[model samples]
Target: MATTGVITVSAVVLRNAAGSSVLTVRKRGTTSFMFPGGKPEPGETAAETLIRELEEELGVNLDPAALRPLGVFRAAAANETGFEVEATVFEHPTVPIGGPAAEIDEVRWLDLGLEIIPDDIAPLTALMLPALRADPRER
Candidate 1:
C-alpha cells in the first residue's frame, strides 16, 4: 500500500490504582482498541490536544500539569489505511473515572499483566504494552 501522510496525535496511559491495567477505547466504527485520545486541532499543543480529547471522548477534564511525557511513538494507523500515526504519549498521574462519550463506543481496562496483549489493539498500544507491564506502579 502507498503511504499516506502522517497523523499527529496525543494520547494518555491511564493506569488503574494497582497499575495492572490501563484504559483503552474503541471509536464508534473501529475494531482496534487504542489509547483514549485524538488528533490535535489547529494550533493546539500536544498537552492541549490530550486535554481536549479526554474531555470530548471520556468526559474527563485533565490538568495539563498532570500529564507526564512518556515519549513519542509512530505506528501504523489503527483505523486509517495507508497512513501512520505519530503520537505524543503521556502518563496520567492518576486514572480519571469516566465512561465512553462522543465518538468512543466502548471503554476497556486492558490488563497489562497479561503475557500477550490481544490482537485487537492498535499498533501503538501494542508497542508500549511491554514497557507498561514490566513497570507497573501505583500513583
Candidate 2:
C-alpha cells in the first residue's frame, strides 16, 4: 500500500563498542520495537528532535556534534497505520549508559546476524535489516 503521508523525524543508530549490535526500544503500551525518536516540534530540526527524544526516552545524553548523518530512511509508521515515517537517521556510535526513561518500557540489542526480528517491530527497523546485515561494522 502507498503511504498516506510521512511523519518526519530523526533517529539514532545506537551501536555497541564493536558496532556489532544495534539498540531497539519499546514504548509504554506499545508492542512494536523501534529506534528512539519522535515527531519534530514546530521549526525544530531533525537532529534536534532526536537529541531531545533520546534524552526523554532513554535517559542518555547525546553530544549534538557527535550525531552523524546516516541519510534519510523511510518505512511504514508503526504506530500510525497507513502512513510512512520519514526518518533522518543519525549514528551515535556508543554503548548507551542508562535505560528505561520516560515512555520506554523495554530495550533490546539486536544482533544483526543472529537475532530473528520479531513481527512486532516498527517499520523503520523492518527496513533496516539489510543494511545492518551488510554493514561492515557488523562483520
Candidate 3:
C-alpha cells in the first residue's frame, strides 16, 4: 500500500488588532505566501510542532497560554512535492521579534478580505478567515 503521511503543520496567527492576518512569502524559489510552520520532527505533537516552527520561521515564541486550536486541513503541497499535507492550524496572538528567517523572504499582515492567498493555502484560509474577521477573540 502507498502511504501518505501528513507532511506539514501550520498556524493562522492573527495580530492583536482585529482586521489583519499574518502571511509569509516563501523565499525566492517557492510559490505562494503561507502561514508560519513546517514539517514536524519525530515524536512531536501538533502543538509542539507548531510552537517550534513558529519560532524558527518567524522568530517569535508563542505563549502556550495563547495558542488556540483552529482546525486541521489537507491540501496538495504548493510546490508540487509528491507528499500531500495535513496542516493542523492554530491561532495565536504574536509580537514580531527578529526579522523573518531566510526561508521567509517577506512577511505581511493581510486583510483577510482583500489578499490573494494561493490555492494550496486557500482551504485553510477559508476555514479560518470568517471567524478571524468577525471576532479576533475567537480561535
Model 2 lDDT tens row, 1-139:
7678888878888877777777888989889988878889998898889888888888888888888887998888888878988999887768455778888999888777765777887879878877877874821
Q: What order do you get sorting by TM-score, best first?
A: 1, 2, 3
True-structure RMSD, every candidate:
1.0, 2.0, 3.7
Question: Model 1 clash pairs?
Answer: none
All candidates: TM-score: 0.96, 0.89, 0.74
State the displacement of the C-alpha of residue 65, model 1, in Å, after optimal TM-score superposition.
1.0
Best candidate according to TM-score: 1
In candidate 1, position 62 carries an lDDT of 85
Candidate 1: list runs displaced more than 4 Å: none
Using lDDT as the measure, the top candidate is 1
TM-score of decoy 3? 0.74
Better of 2 and 3 by lDDT: 2
Q: How well is each residue in 1-139 modelled by candidate 3, as lDDT tens digits?
A: 2335546666556564543555544544665656677777999888888778777766778777777887888765555455556788877765654577847776755566655544545344445566666764423
- Once fitted onto the true fold, the runs of candidate 2 whose alpha carbons sit more than 4 angstroms away are 136-139
Candidate 3 stretches with Cα past 4 Å from truth are 1-6, 115-123, 136-139
Score each candidate by Cα lDDT. Answer: 0.90, 0.81, 0.63
Worst 10 residues of 3 by lDDT: 117-126
